[model samples]
Target: MSNFLLQLSYLIGSITFIVGLKQLSSPDSARKGNLVAAFGMVLAIIGTILFHEHDGNKIGNIPWILGAMALGTVVGWMMAMKVKMTAMPQMVSFFNGMGGACAAIISIVEFNSHPDGAPGYLLVVFLGLIIGTVSFSGSIIAYGKLDDKIKDISSKALTYFNLLLLLAIFVVLGIAVASPEVFGHDVVWLLLGLSAAYGVLFVMPIGGADMPVVISLLNSFTGMAAAFGGFLYNNPVMLTGGILVGSAGTILTVLMCNAMNRSLLNVIIGSFGGGGASGKGADGEQVVKEISVTDTAILCAYAGKVTIVPGYGLAVAQAQHICHDLEKKLEDKGVEVSFAIHPVAGRMPGHMNVLLAEADVPYPKLVEMEDANPGMSSTDVVIVVGANDVVNPAAENDPSSPIYGMPVLKVWEAKNVIVMKRSMRAGYAGIENELFFHPKTKMLFGDAKDTLGKLVAEIKEL
Candidate 1:
């Protein structure tokens, strides 16, 4: 009867998980999805604890497990409560790395416990090891890049070296798995180190311009690693959940890459850190044009229609609220206000959307590039905030620009352009923006939040 109940509970949990995933498809259902998933996870955990052979046995200490659970609960709560919205991307990356690290550790522990290699377990272990190791290191590198602690590093020669190192490590791992006696555990440790190095090398060459895709790919790897670990342990729930997450994440990653017209190999091999004006101008001479904030405000206030394009810089400045505030003020004055959101605008997928949503911006006002581009030419003003690579006109005009061929917000088509920037420094892709030199563009130099707020005040005075 107890065994039957456990099985039933497990089945219910599985169903709940499925429903939760489906619910998560839309923002309206996301909260319910989270609740359902949490409930399912609870059920799964309870069922596992009750049905496990170690329950009330000499090997299992209930108190120890309970204590560990309590500690984990507190840590999770703190992270949830303390992490800011602006920091969520890096936090997500770190958590994903930790999850992958957990899966990797589990695989290593399980392998060491087996006296004779389980016939099919080696593949599962290898899968976990590779995926977890890669995810962990890649995520860390991503965190560093997103946080601006390390500048973008791109080198093809480095990629080649990483590939060679990975191959050598795998070969050693294969030999050690076949003959554990002669090679000793040192080979396993060496492989682990090399696997970590490979992860770093893998992400290092990829520029910050492609970070959102990298984050998605790393998330997929973490999910796959968890699934592999589940397979090794014959846990149906982990297998199902992991596979679902892995597949979904991979699809999202691919879509993001496609949105940028970047192939998986290109993302991995091409150093995309330099984003600016691509290619030589016809005369091979630099163009420098500047405008004032007062002129920009006048154009915006008098315009029949206007659009605001927000990017990572807006988030970095914690300026979403100010931006929203500015938008509201514009609307009150009868200026049309809308947001042009590029698919890869921020550090992660949907990052810009999430930030805007957090600021309580209306969903209707937020428009994707495809839907917004055609309307740009009719726009009276387009205000770009702390955005660089995404708005670089070179994407359309310069064949040699790193971002060429990738669709952008088309802000250049507007009657007047207002760009809020800190300096003349190029974006992560390290290229100059041709849009800055356009006759219609007015540069507002300051912190995004401060600049937008001041503009709001200045407009009211006008």
Candidate 2:
């Protein structure tokens, strides 16, 4: 009877997971979906602790288990509440790394408990160890890069070295499985060290622009590792949860790669961003143009249609609310206002969407890149707020550019474009924007939040 109840709980939990993931496809039901899934998880945990038994013995260590759960809950809640919008990507990487570490530690404990287990059992243990270790180390590196604490270390020799290191990892895995007695207990530690090294080197040279893809890939690795743990323990709920996370992460990674017009292989080996080669303007020389706050307001207020493009700088300045205010004010003046969002716009996937959603912007008002481009030529004015690479013309015009084949927003096709920035510095890709020098483009120099606030005030007075 006890075993039957436990299985029932797992079945309920698995159903909730699927339902929650489906609801997550749209923003309207996302919060409710998350709560439902969390409730299911809690139910499963309670059922397992109360009813699980092995060989007529109930589980022990209740106090320790409950204490650990309480501590982790407090820490996770506090961190989630305190993180800023700009640091969200780093926070995600940090938390995901923790998950990977937990999975890796589980494999270590299991292997140590049964060092001379069957060959098939050892294979599952070894596979979990390798994947989890790599995910943990790689996620940490990705966190460092997103937080701007680490710089890309790109070199042709490093690329070749990484390939060789990967080869060595597989070779070691084969040997460990073929003859577990060759290195005794020491082989496990050796494999751990190699996996960790490969993970670090793998992410060391990847640039900031490719971070979304890396995050997604590492997340899948963690899921795969967790699934292996589920296999080792024969836990149905654990297996279901792990498979869901792994498959979801993989699908998201593929979508991101398609949006960037780059293959998974190219993303791994290209090292496309961070001090890459630059592309010059169409005419090989730049002509400067500038605009004032009053002019920007006047132009936007009287325009028939206006579109706003946001980027990482907008998140850095915490300007999503003020930008939304500007949008509302313009709409009041009989101007049609909407946002243009690129798939890879900010630090992570769906970043810009989340930022705008936080500001209570309606879902219908946020237009995607492919949909927004067709209307660019008819748009009266385009306001680019803290965006850079997404609007740059080099992607279409320059074959020498590293981001040449990647798709970008066609704001240059609009009637007039206003770019907001503090200076003439390059973007995250470390390259100049050819759009800044275009005839229809004008620079509005200032911080995004302050400038947008001024625009809001100016439009109100008109």
Candidate 3:
């Protein structure tokens, strides 16, 4: 009866995971969906502790497991409560790396426990070890980059070196798996080291702009490793959770790659953008037009339609809430305000949406790139708050640019554009925004949060 109950709990947890995942598709239901999935995970953990058994051993290490879980929970909660919005990507990478490390540790313990396993079992263990280690190391590197602790570096030689290193790891894996008896315990350690090294090499050559894709790919790797653990232990909940995470992460990675007009192979080969476009001014020369907050506020107050385009700068300035405040003030005067969100905006997919939703922006007011572009011509004002690459105009106009084919927000199509930023620095892709020099564009130089707050005050005074 207890065994049956455990299986039943696992089923319920799996269903919740699926339902919660589906709910995350919309911003309105996302928070609720996350809670539901977390609840399901809690259920799984409890059911496993009470009922899981293998050869009647029953995971006899409850004290350690409980203590570790508690510690991790406390750490996670503290970080979530204290972390700034700009550091979200870094936090994600940290948590994902922890998950990968856990999976890799499982593989290590299992392989050691079963010194003389079946050939197929050995293969599975090796697979988990390699993939999990890679995810763990690569995720750490990604976290460093997102936190600005590491520079994005890529070269033809480095790319080729990574490819060779990957090949070597696979070769060693094949040899070890084929002759487990001869390879013995040391082979696993050797593989683990090689896998970890490859992970660092793989991510180090990837540019910062490609970090989003790397995050998703590493997530998929962790999921796959966990699935292998499930297979090893014959745990249904573990298998289901792993499969869900793996599949979802892979799908998201593909969507991000497609949005950037790049292929997975090319990304892996380190042929994509990671460094910003330096000194590549739009049309070889720039003629900037500056706008004061007073004038800008007046323009927005009277405009029929105003579309806001947010980027990494918005997050950096922690300005989403005030931007929303600005939007509300504009709407009071009967202006139509909507957000134009490029899929690849900010550092990750759905980044802008998440930021805006946090600021209580209505879901309907968030316009996707494709839908926002067609109506841009009619938009009287486009407020670009701390965005550079998405509104750069290089993607559409410069065939010689690295990001030439990527789809971008058409903020330039609007009649008037107000770009707010701290300075005249290149975007994440290291390219100068041609839109900045466009005849109709106006620069508003200042901190985004400060400027938006001032703009809100100015609009009220008007």
Best by TM-score: 2
Local distance difference test, each candidate: 0.82, 0.89, 0.87
TM-score of each: 0.94, 0.96, 0.94
Q: Model 1: per-residue lDDT, tens digit, 1-462?
A: 666666677777778878998999887999999899999989987877777543444326778878978998899889978988988888898888888888888878877776357536665786688779889988998888777786666555787787798788778767666766766655546667878888888888777568888888999999899899879867778887888889989998999989998897788766685233446445546555666666667777888898999988999899999899989888888999999999988787688999999999999999999999999999999999988889988899888887888888889899988888888787776776888888878788889998888888877777
Off by over 4 Å in 2: 281-284
Q: Report the lDDT of model 2 for residue 298.
A: 95
Q: Please tell me which predicted candidate would have the highest lDDT against the true structure.
A: 2
lDDT of 3 at 459: 94
Model 3, 1-462: lDDT tens digits are 778878988998998899899898876798899999989989888998888777766767899989988998898999988988778888999889988888888889988898678878888888888999999999999999888899878777887888888898888888777887666788889989999999998988776457799999999999999899889888888898898999999998998899988898878884556443433643465578899999999999999999999999999999999989999999999999999998888889889988998999998999999999999999999999988887777788778677778898888889999999898877776666778888989999999999999999999998
TM-score of candidate 2 versus the correct structure, residues matched by position: 0.96
TM-score, model 3 to reference:
0.94
**Model 2 C-alpha lDDT per residue in residues 143-250, reported as the tens digit of each score:** 999988888888888889989998998888887888887879878898899999988989999885688999999998898898898899888888888889899999
- Quote the lDDT for 394 in model 2: 85
lDDT of 3: 0.87
